[model samples]
Target: MSKYTSFPEPGDDHNPFQDPAVTQHSSNTEYATLDLYNPFDNKNGPPPPAYAATAPSAPQPVVPATTPPSRTTPTEPRNYGTSFTPQTAVNATTAELLRKQEELEKKARELERRERELDSHALGPGATRQNNWPPLPTFCPVGPCFYQDINMEISQSFQHTVSIMYYYWMFTACTLAFNLISCLSLFCVEPSGGVGLGLAILWVLLFTPCSFVCWYRPVYKAFRSDSSFNFFAFFFIFFVQVIFYVIMTIGIPGWGFSGWIVSLAALKTSVPVGVIMMLNAILFTAQAAMGVVLLKRVHSLYRQTGASFVKAQAEFATGVMSNQAVRQAAANATASAAQGAFTGAAR
Candidate 1:
C-alpha cells in the first residue's frame, strides 16, 4: 500500500479488477462532472478542505454580550413585587428584638417602682414614709403617731370611700361631744342625772379613740393593702359599734345615753333640756343609720375585692405564725414544758 493513497473518486463504474480500458474510458467523464460541480462557487468561495474540518470545538454556546445589570429594575411591562433583600430581613428581625427589649425594660421599671411603694409602706430601712396623721404642729409636745394620707397611700378608686369614712369618724366625735352637753343640761335640771353626765363624759373619752382604732383604721388598711384579715376585722368591730350606736339611740336612762326615752322624760322637767336631749337622740339615730349604710358599702367593697372568710383565715394564720412575738412566746412555752417534764422525770 502507498503511504499517500488517493481515495476513489465518485461515479467511476470500473473497479481495479475490471479492465483498465473501461476504467480509463469512465475517468474523463467522472473528472469533468467533478470539475464542473463547484458546490460553493456563487455562494461562498469553496468548501473547507478535509484537513480543515475538525471534530469542531464542542459548539461554543452563544453568549449574548451582557452589561452588568442596572441597580434599578425596569419599571415597564411585567410587574415584579418588592423583592426581599437579606439586609431588609435582617433589619426587620433586629427591630423586633429591640422592641421586645424596650417592652421588657419598661415592665422592669414598673415592677421596681411598685416594689419601692411596697417598701415605703412597710417602713423598711431607708423608707421615705413619715408620720403625717394627728397633723399636730411642729412645736407640739406630742408628735404624729400614724402615717395617714389617703391621697398618698390609698388607690384612686378607693379614695372617695375612704374620705367618707374619715368624715364619719369626725361626725361621731362631734355627736359624743353634743351628748356630753345634753347630759350636762339634764344634770342641771335634775341632780340625780349627775350620774348620767359623768358616764357620758367617760363615754366621750373612751369611744372617740376606740371607734377609730377598732374599725376605721382596719378598713383603711384593708383597702390600702387588700388584706382579707383586715377587712374581716373591720366588719366584725364595726358591726359591734353599730349595735352600740343603736342602743345609745334608744336613750336608756342610767346607762349614760340620753336617748329618746330620756328626752321624753326630760320634757316633763325642762323644755330646753328635753329639746337638747332630743337633738342628741337624733344625732345618735343618724349615727346608727350611717353605720348601717357604711357596713353595707364596706361589705360590697369586700365582695368586689374577692376576699372571703377562707382567705381571711389563711391570712390570720400566716400572720400569727410569722409574728416574732408570737413565735417567741410559743418557743418559751415549749421550753418551759420540757424543763418541767425533765425535772419531774429526774425526781
Candidate 2:
C-alpha cells in the first residue's frame, strides 16, 4: 500500500448505511404510507402521475356560477274595490279634475247666453225701434215722436207703478183742459179777465210737454235702466211739479188757475157757472192729492232700489264724458276759447 492511499474498514460491504436495497425499501414504504394517510387526496381519480410527486399541480382558477335573486309572492289575497294603491289614487284625482273643468265650461256658456239676452232687451245691433207713442192715426200728417211700451220696456216689478204714473199724466192733461174751459168762461163773464184765458192756454201748452219731458220721462228711464242720475232728476223735477200743483189747487183768481177762490168769486155772479168752477176746483184738488201720493210711492221705490246722491253725481259725470255729441261740443268750445285768447293777446 502506498503512503497516500486509504485502507477499507472491516465489514464495509455489508453495512446498512451503505446498502442500496435497504435505502430503496425505506423510501417506498414512506411513499405508500403518505399516499394512504393524505387528507387532500382524490381516491376516485387516477393516481397522481409519476412526475406529480416532484412538483406541485398548478392551482385551477375557480369560476363561480351566477344566480338571480328570488322574488317572493304575496301570501294573502286582496279585494279589487277596497284595495288602495298609488296608481289608483292618481287616476281618481285626474278624473275629478276633468269633471270640474267641464262644469266650469258649462257655467261660462250660460253666462254668455245671459249677456246676449240682456243686450237684445235694448236696441241691439241692426234692430229697429218704431215710433209708437201718442198712437197717432196713419192718415194724420203728424206722426208719433217717441217709442214707449211699459210692458216691453219696463221690468215686471215696476210695471204697475209706471202704469199708475201714466194714468196720472193723462189726468193732468184732462185737468188742464178743464181749467182752460173754466178760464174762458170766467173771461166771458168779465172782459178784463181775457188775460186769464190767454195765460191758461199758455199753461196747457207749456206744462203738458214740460211735465212729460222733465219728470215723467226721467222716471221712465230711471225705472227702465236703473239709472241713478235719472232717478235724481225725476225726484228734483217731480218735487217742483208737485209744489206747482199744490199752488194751483189753492185757486188764485187772476193767475188763470181754476182754484177755490176763483170758483167762490164766480158764485156771486151766476149759480151754474159757480157750480162749474167748483167742479173744476175739486178736480184741481184731486190732481194735487194724486201727485203727492205718486211722489211718496216713487220715493219709496227709489229707496228700495238703493239710489244715492253720490251715485247720481258719478253717473252724470260718466254719461256726459261718454256722450259723443257732448264731447264734440266740448272740444269745439275749448278750441274757440283758445283761439279767442290768442287773438286777444296778439291785439
Candidate 3:
C-alpha cells in the first residue's frame, strides 16, 4: 500500500473504506478519508490546518443594511419613485371629498337664509300669516272679462297699495278712452266737421300724454314709493283732471269739444250721436265714481301712515316758506301794498 493511499481497493469487501477513486478525489480536494463506522457523523471530518497563509485582500463594497421589500397583493399596483403610498393617497382624497361636501352644505344653508330674508322683505310689515287679498270669485257672472285674473296678477306683481291704485288708474283710463271716442264721433257728424275732427284729434293727442305725465305717473309713483310729497302731488293733479273731465262733460264746445250737451244738440239730426252722448255721460259718471273711490282709498292709506292735518299744514308751510320764488313774490306784494297805501294817504 502506497503511503498516500488512505483506503483499500473497491473489490476488498472485508475492509469497509473501499473506494480508491473516492479516497483519492477526497485527498486531492483536502477532505478527510471516510471512516466506515462513523460515516454520517459531523465529528469524523478532518481538523482545520493550524497555520493559514494570509493573502492581500481586495476592498469590499460598503453595502447599506436593507430589509427585503414586503410582498404586495397581486391586485394592488406597485408605486415607483414617488413618496405617496396608496393608503396615504386614498386618505388625502377622502379628506378633500369631505372638505368639498362641507363647503357645499355651508353654501346651501346660506342660500336658504337669503331666500327666507327676501321672502320676508317682499311680504312687508303689514303682511299677515294669511294673504290679505280676497280669494278669486268662483262664479264670475260677466263671463271672464279677466278682471279677477288681472287683479290677481297685479296683486302678485305689486305691493298691496300699488295694486289697488293700478286698478283705479286702469278704470280711469278706460273711462277717458270712452269719452274720447264719444267726442270724436260727435265731431265727425257736426257742421264744420273737418275743423271739429282736427280739434278732437289734437285734443286726444295732447291730453292723453298730459294725463299720463301729470296724474297717472304721479299716482303710480306715490303708491309705489309711498312718498308723501308724491301723494300730495297726485291728489292735486287728479283733482285738476276730474275738474277737466267735468268741464268736458258740460260740452263748452271750443275748450275740448267733449261735452254731452253738444252731442245732445247733434242728437236731433243723428240718433247715433245721441246714443254716443249718453254713453259718454255714463263713462264720465263712472270716471267720477272711480275718482271718489280712489280718493277715499288714498285718504285711508294716508291715515294708516299716521299723517294728520297738522303734518299736512307743516309740509305746506315748509314748501311755501322755503321757496325762493314764493319769498320774492311775497316781498313784491308787500312793497306794492305799502306804496299803494302811501299814495292813497297823499290823495
| Winning candidate number (TM-score) | 1
Question: Per-residue lDDT for 177-282 in model 1, tens only?
Answer: 9999999998987999888989999999999999889999999999998999999999999999999999999988997898999999999999999999999999
As for lDDT, the candidate ahead, 1 or 3, is 1
What's the true lDDT of residue 123 in model 2?
60
Candidate 3 — which pairs collide?
A: 251-259
lDDT of 2 by residue, 1-347 (tens): 43455545554454546668667865774344453444375653544344347546779998988788675866665666787778889999999999999999978866665665577666666896788878989999999887787766777689899999988998998899999998888878878888888989998999998888888889999999888899999988988998888878888777888889989989998777788888999998999899889999999999999888999999999999999999999999999999999999999
Candidate of highest lDDT: 1
Clashing pairs for predicted structure model 2, backbone only: 251-259
Score every model by TM-score.
0.63, 0.62, 0.42
Residue 92 of model 2 has an lDDT of 100
Using TM-score as the measure, name the better of candidate 2 and candidate 3.
2
Worst 10 residues of 2 by lDDT: 30-39
Give per-residue CA lDDT, model 3, range 141-197, as digits (tens): 433221122222222234456666556665656655665676677666665555555
Residue 129 in model 1: shift from native, Å? Answer: 2.2
Ranking by lDDT: 1, 2, 3
Counted clashes in each candidate structure: 1, 1, 1
Give all candidates' CA lDDT scores: 0.86, 0.84, 0.63
